[model samples]
Each structure stands twice: as structure tokens, then as C-alpha cells.
Target: MPEKVIIRSIISPHQRESFTQFIPLSPDMTREIGRTVKEIFDSLGGAALLKSSRDVYVKPNGIDAKAYCYTRPEVVRAVIEYWQSAGARQVYLMENSTQANYTRVVFEVNGYRDICRDTGAIPLYLDEEKTIGFEFTGRKSIYDGDPRGYDRSHCEMPVTVTEKLIRRRDENLYVNVPKLKTHSMAGVTLGIKNQWGFPVHTSRGHDHNYNLPYKLTDVLSLLRPDVTLIEGIEGTVYGHYPVTALADRCVKPFRVLIGSLNVAAADLAGAKILGLDRADVAHLDQAIKRNLTGGVTGLDDIELEGDFSTLENIDILGDKPSSGKYPADLFDFFPWDVKVLKGKELACREGCVNNPLTLLQVLFHDHNGRGGWTLVMGKGFDPDEIDEIQGRVLVAGHCAIEEVAERLVKRLGKKKVYLSGECNDLAATAEAMFHLMKVNPVSFLPRRRGAAVLAFLMARLHGSKSRVPNPLSHLIKMV
Candidate 1:
């Protein structure tokens, strides 16, 4: 059994200091916070719970480089600072960003690069590391935690996790610092939601799988976290449905949640603080059904240890679409991309808004727009639509690639029309879009062709996305 969960509420968002400024903590304040953190570990085991001879991993929410959506560097730095002071010998900050080969890009852009430099915590990009695949024969499990409800024990689980991270499971501890964000599918992305990053598979680039609910359970069962910290300094509401780009999605909850020895207790506490019902959070409810969260059916089941008086005052906003499906939130995210995604009739049959809308998010967040973007994508466009496109146009997928290649070259110029081979090749698509975006990585480590070939071949051994060769020759130069 885990110790009682702890909730520390910071009502004043404005009073908080620099998110990146690492300063000397007042001895009094440090001791108070440290005492609270020590109790959190005592619930799991003892003060040495984080002490290890090998590398410890501080897993934070860095799904993308987007602002107010991922975990803040200060939150991660606090964890590193605390664990090191608590007798930890070494620690590594790690996470797998969505769909980008360059996990380093996400970390560097989102402030982890500097966090690692100042705190002496190494940054490990999970996707860049080698992966190992496993399948539970008698147990059926999903990777993305699909809410459709599949029996985990009977499903074939081909989940791939970073071998470097998996092998370290027995040698060290993990502190999962998940951001309090509203997920499009699983409702609230709390402690349990953070584990979804372990699997190397994807329902799609967008982070929603039919089996996400169960997939999350499988990951939790596999790599159990010793401490789960939920940060609500900044969050997203109606996260999937954007009203006005970045403004509508973000929220300032001004709070922090801590839990351990049990993942369910931690995430349950997170949902409660957000004023969310346990019944509504699919993975949390599913975790309860399997008796995974120590039989925590709701927040009332867990005991709180710290300041939690303002549970009701917390404003999480709605998780679902507040105003129904709106693409403007996504399109408006980038200033260069003003034409708005047309060809609604051409949305992929798999899921109408999934590919088109998500592609725009991936492109803008991952790359820098030079001339900005004018995207016209999906299966619907008649070749005639190509003539109407302005600025640099990106025609995604092989479906649209065939029609626009020649026309785009002639009208826009050879540099303008970018074609991706696979229909949903986000990596390839990103490489194309970025050529025009002129994205500047935090630091560039130029790799020779031999190095790229060596990395590519090694990835082949691990069944990685690197198995697919990048057509953009310059991408090899970018790394």
C-alpha cells in the first residue's frame, strides 16, 4: 500500500518566480518542501527510495515543444534537485516526444536542454535510444489506452519500450512529473496519462488509440513509478477543441500533486484537484476496475497529507469541445498558416479531422516557418485546387502528391512544392515543411553520412521508425 497522497496548492500564479531562473531556495522554504517530499517517498518505502547507484530517470511531460502544454523546466529541476539532495548518485531526465525522430529538439526547445545543463541531470531522448519489443502471450494489452474497453489479459501486446530505460528499471527509481493537461481522448492526462509515452507504437501521431485506456494500464503494470508528481502550473482545457489557438487551450491551475507506491492514487488525486469526476476519466476508471490503483474508485478513497483545502476552487475547464469541432484553433496556432485547411470532404476516412488537423500542429510546433505555411492536404483535392494555393504549399500523403508535384514545381518553384511519400508520414512531412519553416534547432550536431547510416542500421535492429530512410538528404545534416 502507498502512503497518503499529498496536494500542495499555490493560489497565486503571479507570485511564482521565473520558470527558468534557478535560484537559491530559502532554507526555511526548502526544508518545508523537502519535508513534504520526504513524506511522499516514505509512503512508498523510505528516504533512500530515490537513492541508487545507477542512473535515475525523471520522466516529465514533454509531448511537444508547445507552450503551456508540456511540463515546465522548473518542475523537473525541482525533482532533480530534491532527488540529488536525497542521496541519489545520478539522474537522467527523459521522455519520448510525439512523432519526431529528434526528441532532442523537443527537449531543447522546451527548456530541458538548459535544465539539464544547470542541474547536472543528463537528458536522455528515449526515441533516439534503441528499443526492445515484448508481447504478453496470455495477456491482451493496448498501448494508447483506447477507451473502447478491450480485455487486456487476452490481447497481444507488441509494445516497444526503450531498452536503455527498460534495463535500468531494476537499478534505479523513476519520478513521473506529468503536466495537468486535457487530453482529447482520455479526458484528463494526469499521472496515469503520463505512462502512455513508454510504448514506441502510436494509434497515430495525435496520441489517441482505440486501446489507449488499456495500453496505459499495460505500461503502468510494466514500469511502475515510485513517485508521480502532477504539475498544474499551466494546463490546457478543451485541449482538443481550440477556440483561439494557444490562448483558449492554456490554463493556470497554480498547484502541484504528489503520489507514490500506487499510480492510481496519484492520478486520482490529480483528477480530484482538477474538479474532474473519476467516472469520466477512462484510464483511471479502467485502472480501478482491474484493481490496479489499490482499489481507488474515486478521490474519496485516498487520504491527503498536505494543503488541499481548495479542491473545489480549481478551474480545469471542460475537456471536450466547448464549441464543437473547430480547426481554427489549430490553424491559428501558426501565423504563416492562414489559408485554413480546406477540402473538408477529403478528410481521411479513418478519422476525418485526425490527420489533417494534427499534421498542422506537428508541423508548426516542430519546425520554424520561414515564409510561413500554406497547407492544402488530404485525399479530397481535385488537381485544380493546386492552382489556387498561395505561398509555399505542402501536399501531404502519396494520394495528393501525384497530382501536385509537377504543377507545384512550375508555379511555386522547385523549392516550394514538397511531397511526402507515405500518406501519413509525419516525420517525412515535417522534414518537408521545415525546409521552408527554417527551424533552428537549439544546437546542431552535424552527422556524417557514415554516422547516419550507422544509426539507421542500428535502428533497424530495434524495429524503429529509423527503419524508414529519410528522403530529405538535408535531415541528415540537421542532426
Candidate 2:
């Protein structure tokens, strides 16, 4: 008989009809979360896992500092409190934020510093710590024989993790806390996708293209979480980083928490909660294929603890999961006059295609849509085929730069051509787009003018070298 992975899902008594109703952390909500976590530990032989002498490290999904994008601080605090009550030696909350952003800034902006101070839990910024190299022997490329695929020559991938996590991995507990949300690239961001924070920001772009799923799975194979807890209290729809203005339509109040010992099993349940099947998520499919599901061969192998059927299916990317294509009407609602001309040959949904599109979505929604530019991505665009080109030309990604940047620049003059080179470099993309639209990049920040200026200064003084485009450097040009 195949090993059964036990998944515990708890639905809170707090239910609201409106999706926009913001649920703040209350005493009742805390009690429910605490009970749910205790129940999960009890089911998993609490005596063996929750030891008094063990060190605990909790990894929360701090992808972005924005609300509803990262893991809720309330959830992290509950996990820390539980471990502390069990007499754990130490409980550390750690994360490396997404590219172009600093983890320290995220901690400050997301109220993690207060959580750490109140709970006596230390905040470990992985970006500032030293990284150790681990061997990766898995298949390097998703494509069989493509020269442009992930480099097979380099067998070691350096991840930013402390020596404690590397040396005392078996002596302690590692928990993964990720928010349940749909991704424009990976279909869904859950426990499995949360490990993307392990790699340094500079090296992330190496395998950020079509091979992202395999890369994410490879990272999981190296450092699998001991406990996977997905915070589903409030889930984001359409995509993970929807602006606050769009929260009414984008955020859903699920009031549910899902946990499991196996990351794959936890993600499978989380994906199902988001109305995604195993086939819809490439990483989940790859994890099962590689036997990383902790004997969860498929969705049928899971033994659910709660009434999963009561949870309605929240649409993943407008009810079109696994399509690997952005919604046809993503830009229709906005009155942005920008024209996106993608190449006919190759467009990796995970990288060049979605990166700029997501940024554009943010610009359109929050910044009032900066228009009058022609953005070109991917490859195989013959300059001769295009009869008339709109406004200024912005070439994105290495593929587009290599294919048509020179010709486009020659036709449009040097002043009109803006190049943003790299697969998923949000910093470069933002700079190019801002330049083309003639908008101040600082206007995109959520903080007020004074706070934004102070935050930018603080980020530069004590931020990681791996941070792309440096927040201060980008803001300096605009100011």
C-alpha cells in the first residue's frame, strides 16, 4: 500500500459575504489558527516533531511587501508562539524577498519587525547571510537538446542559507508558510513555489525561463520543508500581486488554513483549493513524477481531515488554468494606449512574457496607465513584416534584444529605443517602461512621499548586494 500523506485543513467560523471585507487579526481568529496548528501537530505525532530542545526555522512567503501578496504576519506569529510554548530553543522567521526588492525593506514595510519583537522571534534575512553551494544532479533542461536551456556544466547551485540550516538540518524543524494565490507564471504559488526564495536574486534569472518549474522542483528536492502550512485566510485571484485598488475584485476571503508534513501534498491540497488540478501546475506535476510528493501519487492519495468539498473553487487566472497564456482581456479593461508586440517564435510564460505584463498591470491599475509605447518581447520578429511602429520602441529580454533591437533602433533612432535585457529582471523592465512612458518610477511605491524617501535611503544603507537596480539608485534618477 502507498504511504498516505495526512493533510489537515481548518475553516474558521468567520465567514463574510463580501470579498472586500478585510479580516484583521483578532483574538477569535488567533484562537482558531492556534487550534488548527495544534491539531495538525497532534495528528503528526507531536511528541516526535515538537521537541523542547529543537531549533525552529519558519520560512514565510515574503515575495513582495505589499498586502495580500506575502504571508500574513499574524499566521507567522501563531507558528512562532506555538514553537515557543513547546520550549523550542529558538524560533527564527526568515525570507529573501523577490528580485529588485530588499528583504529588510520588506520586513519593515510588512510589519514583520513588530511580530519579531512581540513574539521574541528573530528575523533572519537570507540575502544578508552567506550562501552555501549544493550539488544539483537532476535533469538540467526542460527541452531535450536546446543550447539555450539551463546550463548542465554547472552542477552546483548556491543558495543563501545559514550554516545552522545546513549542518543541523536534521536536528531542527523547518516550516514553510506560504500564502495561497494564483501565479501568472507558475499557475499557483504555494508551498513548493515558496522555496524560490532560497536562491540568490542574481542567480535566479539563470533558470527563470520555461525551465522554472523544473528549477523549482530541483530546489525542493534539495531543501524540502518539514511542515508546510498554507495561509488561505485571504487568497488573491487573477494573479498574486494585484494592486490594493483592485483588492475588491482580486482578493477572496477563504478563512481556511491547510497544513501537511509533505510540501508536495500540502501544495496539492492548496492547488485544489484554488481550483487547480495536478496537471495545471507544472511544478506539482513534476514533483509527483519525481516521487517528491511523499507517496502522494495524485490527488486521490491524500487523506483530507476537513470538509474540502465545502471550499468552493476560486478561479485560477480567470477560470483558465494550465493555459500558459495570459487572459485575452487582461489589458482590455484599462485605457492604456501601450501596444505589446510579442514574438511569434518563443514566449516563456514564466519569464519575459509575464514579467513585463505583470508590471504593466500594476502600472495600469495603480499608476493610472502610462501609455504611448510599443513593448516587444520574445523572439522571431522580422522588422520588415511590421509596416508601421507605434510611439517609442522598448525591447525586452535577451531574445528580443538579439533578434530585433538593432533593426528597431536603426529605424526609430537611438533616442526612441529602450532596451531592458534579462529574462525576468523587474528592475530593468520598470526602468525601461517608466522611461518610455515618461512617468516617475517613485509614483509606483505604496508609501507616501516622505516615507518613500526614507525607505529608499534605508534600503540602500543596509541592503543586499544582490538587490537589482538598488531601490535608492532607481529613485535617485527619478527624483
The candidate that wins on lDDT is: 2
Compose the digit string of candidate 1's lDDT tens values, residues 413-475: 866666654435556555664465554322121223344445445544545432121445334
lDDT of 2 by residue, 1-479 (tens): 33223444444454454533334566777777888777766676554685434888889999776668888877888888888887788888888788767676677667776799898899877776656666454564435675666743132322435355555567778888999888878888999999888877766765567778887887777778888888987777677777666776677666777877878878877777677778888988988888877778666666666544332353423433465332222233443578888889997778888888877777676676568778888988766654378457777788888888788777777777777776777777777766555456556445444554565566566555445553333333320
Deviation in Å, model 1, residue 347 alpha carbon: 8.4
Global lDDT of each candidate: 0.55, 0.70
Q: Could you tell me every candidate's TM-score relative to the true structure?
A: 0.64, 0.86
Measured by TM-score, the strongest candidate is: 2
How much is 246 displaced in model 2, in angstroms? Answer: 2.5
State the local distance difference test value for candidate 2.
Answer: 0.70
